[model samples]
Target: MRRFASCSLILAGGLSIVACTPDQPAAARQPVFEDVSFRQDYSKKYSATDTTLALSHVATDRNGAVQILSSRGLLQPYAGEFLYPGTLVADKSFRPLRDKKIRAISTYRQQRVYLDDKAVFSNAWAGTLYKKHTLPNAKHFAGGKDFSFLVSDGKKLQYLNDGIAWEGSAPAGLIDIVYDARRNAFMLLSPSEISVFSATEHTVTTFYTGKGLTCLALTNNAREWVVGTHAGYFTLDAASGRQRGTLQRKLPCADLTAVEEINGKLWFGSVRGAFMIRPDGKCNYYACKRWLPSDTVIDLAPGADSSVLVLTDRGLGEICFKSMTLADKAAYFGQQVRRRHIRHGFNATLENLEAGNLGTGTLDDSDNDGLWTCMYLAAEVFRHTVTGADDALENCRESMDALERLYTINPMHGFPSRSFERRGYKYDSEPWRRAEDPEWDWKSTTSSDEAIGHMFVYGVMAELMRDEDLKKRAVVLMDSLMQHVLDNNMYLVDWDGKPTTWGKWNPEYVNARPAMVGDRKINSSNIISMLQTAYYFTHREVYKEKAFELMTRQGYYENLMRPMREITTAPASADDWSKMLSEAWNHSDDEMYFLGYWGLYRYAFNDTLQANFREAIIDHWQAERPEKDALWNIMTAVTGAQQFDLDEAVWYLQEYPLDLVSWKVKNSDRGDIMKIDTNFRNQHTAEVLPPDELEICRHNANRFGLDGGNGGATEYSAGDIWLLPYWLGRYLGVIGTPDVVKP
Candidate 1:
């Protein structure tokens, strides 16, 4: 529509195009280069006014006959993408899925991907469904064609399969799939389970992954592969299910996606965008903010030319490999350059990864936490404010003479470790497939399975960097892991025939415990991440059930939380920790931890249930007040939904606070460079608290030391981002904050 890239557009149309920098006033720091791009597709606009969602995530088939789209990726502002419009699952007046509740949508030829909007309104939510302006096209392709399943009991899947009848106990949520040449099978993957069925038959090996798979990358060695899961990413033993080594993690984080190998370089995407390591073991990243114009790259497909195609929030953008430009911003304070705000080198993030800190290798001196900062910094693309920051994004152009090879389209979908290596990571291991356990006593945690999970997750991210042919192969790899990890023997429930500890502790229902015991059981959080994909691919009720079960049956307040009553201090691993909190309670059944509680709370839905959770949260956090600290206390207030005296807490939080994300986009209509979304003013209730107040609430807790034994903040997790949700909730006056209109 408008040509704006590579040209000096002092001012394009009505928008100011200034140089980028925080030093200059926001007005002066306009977008000097709009990062504009256009696809010279003589194919014409397709006459498809397709009033549908754009590609949130995308993948090209090995056959090149179809483009698979997921419409969902990581945890970002928008719920998910609206990629494919063909399979909206409709009745008569057909249209792409267009309901507000339809959180995400992706496409891959015949297959489609979807994620439910746990927020806004759900199917179980009756009031908003019948609204006058609601989307008439709202429907569930998996649960039922007519969009009948409600949110309260709706079993939204992580992925779906071609068979629509909804297979039971098949591990509900399925995400990616791949063809396995070794076994001539199709590996079906999901959060709850992984099923590898013969392309010619249905022989399978189902298994479970607690935190869900982060990525899946295939090695040049066809027979083996890598899998990144909740714990970490690692290479796997093709036959033995042994982990090679972990390539990513710092304390821990999940939701890994995207992976690829270009010109001897390896690449992968995690929370934000892509990353890469050079042939010589150097690493680098892509500046998504400058290169692709999206904070996160849902999918990265290599092009015929040594370039990469990135699917992001804005649209499909490409970075030409041969046309590489080292990002360098001019130093204003240095010599008052001609440009008001200087633009730095082409892509600093990439350079950093490959060269280590400040143009060095892994030996450049960095600690675990330091290494993580570098990784996250590289991933960080330009913030929305356009202050010229490197958010996560990486790339590789020069192709292998366009030979591009990747995951197969069948089962056993994954790569062997012999592919690529990073500064602190290597392809030194194989896939991990643990057998199931009926009970506890024999259960034990192994670094191997956990490591492979991480690899699978990263593999997904790497495939995104490949060409169309390779992208399709990546899906096949995903299918293999799902077959073995998600459904077949999910829960990693096997105890090597030892006395199982599963079901050892009572699954907490609200505030009550049903039964109890100990010895740590197989967990299920990792499977949750995979569900978003399964819901889209197969639409299996079983997938939805798993997510629902985890969300409902388990929680931090009652089920998995460590009893502080008899606590000495927080334990790192389950093995190191004690079961009894204060001698008053002892865990005998399943071993529940903070991860379970946090993971479960992530996908909570329902008005009454959410309220119920609110009460439990209040009770628990208030208890932790004894050891109240900034991190822990603020976390409790945000997620727990506890009530507090507003103006009072507000003053304190503002007086001393950390970071508070604003959900509403700021407007620039106020004669200022940017504007604030005042809509949140009327969203809060008098009884509820604001972010500032929320901060104050925590500090106050720290003062008296109420629940936590007055301890300090625990390591922050992605869950910490809940601040976005909390602020958004408050701004909308949906539950908290003063609902009084500003004007």
Candidate 2:
């Protein structure tokens, strides 16, 4: 296991002992399986302004195509289509199934059967019709083995097989009928009882009775029967009418509207949403716009390609699963970043999307453009260092060009602008200033976040890149940025000749904040990291001099070493700024601090300082463990800690939704999460929801925020948010290459 901190071969004069190349692989890496879980949601809006709100049932035919029953008839999903309802039509019938009114539908081994008030029909089987007995106003249908079927009109239950019909005692309050092939019987579900009618005996016998049964499903193994009710659901042994377990109520939602057994997993639908019982007993809840068009789940069924189709009041949510490795996911995100997230060489957001359509969006600038670009740049640098991919190198070069332009675009010598755009197209209200070139505009008021990101990437490039020009340019940029701070009295001077609000690292401004305020610790940590990075890369004595001065003379060491538990809200007597800054945990500071850790620990002035930096990083990681953040966990691994929640980090990566649309998601009213009292960190629950269930946001946003998002108007880049940590893990040898061939 080669640590990057110890792997650096460069001496004080920047002499390399060995040339790094793509062929050089890291040793002692653990291989991760390629089969990772990810979700793909399929939905269609009813109208331009309305989602489909009348879906009733969903099913999959033998051809592995999904059919959703809604008020508008059967609907199917088409490839490359979104937000358009594709109504299903009969294959060879004179009258299409879409035109005729369908009351009930079912799929058997080789046939898709449907029934109206008049007669039952099939798309596959064509047995002799039962002309002797007329249909008894059938409203439900279930297909059995070899054309054997059952129908119920909510009053009587009948078995129709081989042109003959046998009447069975109809259970009172009949709701649904399902065929159990293993038992060769029809399971009749009523409000409070289950009656099994054997085809051989032709007799209906009471099997089980419950207080408020709504639906029933036999497990795939035919060992247990799951029954749902208005309150919750429970299981029973299939052989006997005995309870398999106690009434299980700890679910995503207790009000079970529908239930289905798919792929050996029991999926429950409620008025609020749909959830699946994982093997571990915890529920993988699927709610909000991210999973469904609406949260009112009406039905659940097995879907095509190992997926689940959730029919809600508003359209369908097809949760599809595809086998992928972390590397495969990285490649997918690489294509995603190059496809739409690039804006003038900087990784940017796709804003003002039309109904979450990926093609109907435009790249837009943000306040932290430099920071975002540098994060993406670091990802590319890590990728180039690991795989030596030409595309990754090209990406790094292009982004490096953009970052270098930021320093020169503005009048200040080393003050990097937040972002830049062509002449007057900039629409943001941020302070946009004119560049020397009349055709361009540059944003001002760069903060310490950007500085830290810049230093981190620069240090990474200086340490890892094989290209001499890039390494030298990185060192030069580091020297320039640090010299600017030193020349301007340890501050990033803005266009108005004043320190940017967040760029002040001078002792006067930093020490003024109370000890408990997070700004004090974060500022001290970031400035020292910046100085160390500058000194390490350029071997400049001034950077080292200032770093030691900040540590010994100005009490910055004590500030940085303060235990994370000691950080709290400012006292009542504190100033308004300090109070506001310490009101709650700033997740943006976490991003800044972790990003700074790369340069802080790796580019330390001495081994003893490196040890202290490692301790500080581990302390911060301990505080952040509850979030289960992949980036934070992976970044903490750089410090060589024994345990950094690697499993949680992998879970974070695997559970992150592929859909980056900023769709409105609400979970504050969820019954599953155990709500905790408010605290300084604002953690809403004992455990945070998976990334996909929450709103789409950058790593800087709080993972515990229950609800947020614009109504599907924006899409975020995967570059900084996803690729950075994955590639960092790869470079650090904590994550291995795909176990299988690249797909």
Candidate 3:
């Protein structure tokens, strides 16, 4: 049964609907499986064939020779007549078969058969010799079970039973026919109509009518028929001729050529490619050269082991739906993160290394490597908690070690560097200087974002890590970082012996701004959370004392409690910093605010304070839902707020394309998406571009933007965007663990 994440909070009434449910039931929620489809060309595999098969029509003969009718003439497995060879044949005048204008072919009782404008004939090698037979006035032929055959002569349909007794003509204007054993009847189809001729009733019944209906197939349940039209396909009730549902709105392409049901799945072949509709009505598309020999799918045939044989104009190919699952996809992408994106245990990189191999260079090119590494470490820690995997624990330890180096490598006590590198190695043009130790160098200009990330991970590690040494290490780092701020009057001192820009969280700087300024509330909320986290892990009274001092004396708590919707752009001030703060939304600040909330609501506040924090978090999340950010939604779920958009969070994760390469994606001229006007900062456009067409995206990219950078060149790691939210969802009990079936 399909199950979704549940919410307990009543969003409209602001009341708790129920107590939090136990984790076991939440863990048992079933995951909705979806198909990730890609296309490829296999035409090159058959380039050495003797004839250029156009694949206008394909059928397997009795001897298992896959024959294809091309513009060049009849081509099959063998060319010679008496001693038939396995080589491809193109001659129409071979042996007893001499029809150049053949329309269709079928296998009947181990006999190779063909139909032309005038007759139906067969040339079979029987009893060590070739035997031939021809029946006149046959235009087309369709074979059914038990050697039953339906023959058409341009205008009439006739059925021949297994005993070779001819059934009288029943209908005119018939274009194609197929037999359904379940109904014990023959289905006759025309360009715009379908009729069922039941043998028992000896009556013809019209089933459906639609313009340009091209193909028909019985559904897996044998209760309905999938009728394909030029625009799309729909389901029609077999017993009553009532329309079940039309799927034109759900299809990716409309110009369908053929439709077939194989193994309970409906495969629609079209001019653009093929679309497979599952029993559950989920659609998966295969059109590109990566999955198809050509975009023009002529026909489809069922193959062994639940696979489908695709006949395109270029060649034949097979699609195996069982080859991979969502678990396999997640594991493959996780491997990609480790192999291609990791830099010294950090799972996030600004650009992928060339050739799947690292060059002789330092991995500290990204200034925020420490922050990205901390986020990755938090993901691993959550993974370990959920799955109890020793490898995930080991990964967390390694990443934590790298994160520790960011603080220790710098000379200033308890101050973390933006990033560190080996001596004399430089690729980026960011500000850098040699450390006190001669062997390495570290970057400067660390911002508040790094601090918040450090504290967030520190809180999580202190709670989740089982090893005593790791726990102590986390507490020590928390103490040192918090003490640095306390000693330096709430500012992170840079290498130049001054407060770095964006590192000022002191009461003086925060209180000087108006309440309407975003930084005023953001700084107050972040500092309170940092102090709370420092106190929670270290059990230090000074941390709590400092937190309350700011809240009570500087109005920090009230500032943070202001409804997010009430905070808007403030009037410009004379000072440059104030003027900058008065501008419209800074999305980076949104990233920092949500990231800091992990500690703010989870570790800092008691039950009473947390209730108020939940209100603030919900308001912020309500404003952020328009962006459809998975990270923000997942983070909000940790607060246990009802109506947190859990479904949209999962949709974001599922809709995110598998391609993580940061190719340049431009969407300014796209005609398919809706465009709206916006006044928010950093939101360049209102178009919600498809994931595949957008630039290689990360969590921070605007989801509604029309343009992305990279020039089709660099690709970034999807670790932070994918792994973080996925594991967080698991840890928060929003995403259930999938059942593992060992091979």
Candidate with maximal lDDT: 2
TM-score of each: 0.27, 0.91, 0.65
* Candidate 3 lDDT tens digits, 448-533: 98898889888888888776777788889989999999999999998788998889899889888878788988998889889888
Off by over 4 Å in 2: 1-54, 70-73, 81-101, 126-133, 162-164, 427-430
lDDT, candidates in the order shown: 0.30, 0.80, 0.66
Worst 10 residues of 1 by lDDT: 39-48
Pick by TM-score: 1 or 2, better one: 2
Give the worst 10-residue stretch by lDDT in candidate 3. 39-48
Candidate 3's displacement at residue 338, Å, is 3.8
Taking the tens digit of each residue's C-alpha lDDT, what string does model 2 give over 72-92?
666665442343233333223
Q: Each prediction's Cα RMSD? A: 34.0, 4.2, 10.0
Q: Global CA lDDT of candidate 3, please?
A: 0.66
Per-structure clash totals for the candidates: 216, 2, 8
